[model samples]
Target: MRLGECRQLRVKDMDVERRQILARDGRGQKDRITLLPEKAVTILR
Candidate 1:
């Protein structure tokens, strides 16, 4: 995801169980799902 998308991220956009980060509005102004690292999940939590 882009910096803008990360800044706009919300709790609802996180799928911890799935280990994915949902970018509701990405680089092309489109939605995408990116991998969420285990280490990052702990930080995000």
Candidate 2:
């Protein structure tokens, strides 16, 4: 996702506390939460 989009994501929309990324698809028709790897999360932080 783009930085702008990421910024638009709210804390409630995130599953970070659960080690996941809740994202909407390009068409905005689908939503899902995907697991994030520990290393990637550390780097992003």
Candidate 3:
């Protein structure tokens, strides 16, 4: 994800069960889907 979008992330943006991140206000000022890797998920938790 772009730095700006990542900065805007909220708890609601992370879907742990589905293992995905909802990247809002992205590089082009759009929302997009990004993956949440298994390793990262464990770490985040």
How far is 16's C-alpha from truth in model 2 (Å)?
3.5
* Per-residue lDDT of candidate 3, residues 1-45 (tens digit): 788887889999999989999998776678998999999899988
**Candidate 2 — which pairs collide?**
none
Give a tens-digit lDDT track for model 2, residues 1-45.
545446556666655457787766533556666677788667767
The Cα RMSD in angstroms, rounded to one decimal, for candidate 1 relative to the true structure is: 1.4
- Candidate 1: lDDT of 16? 93
Q: What is the C-alpha lDDT of each candidate?
A: 0.88, 0.63, 0.90
Better of 1 and 3 by lDDT: 3
Query: Candidate 1 local accuracy as lDDT?
Result: 0.88
Clashing pairs in 1: none
List runs of model 3 lying over 4 Å from the truth: none
Could you tell me every candidate's TM-score relative to the true structure? 0.81, 0.48, 0.83
lDDT of 1 by residue, 1-45 (tens): 689989999998889989998988777789999999899989877
Q: What is the lDDT of residue 20 in candidate 1?
A: 92
List CA RMSD, all candidates.
1.4, 3.6, 1.1
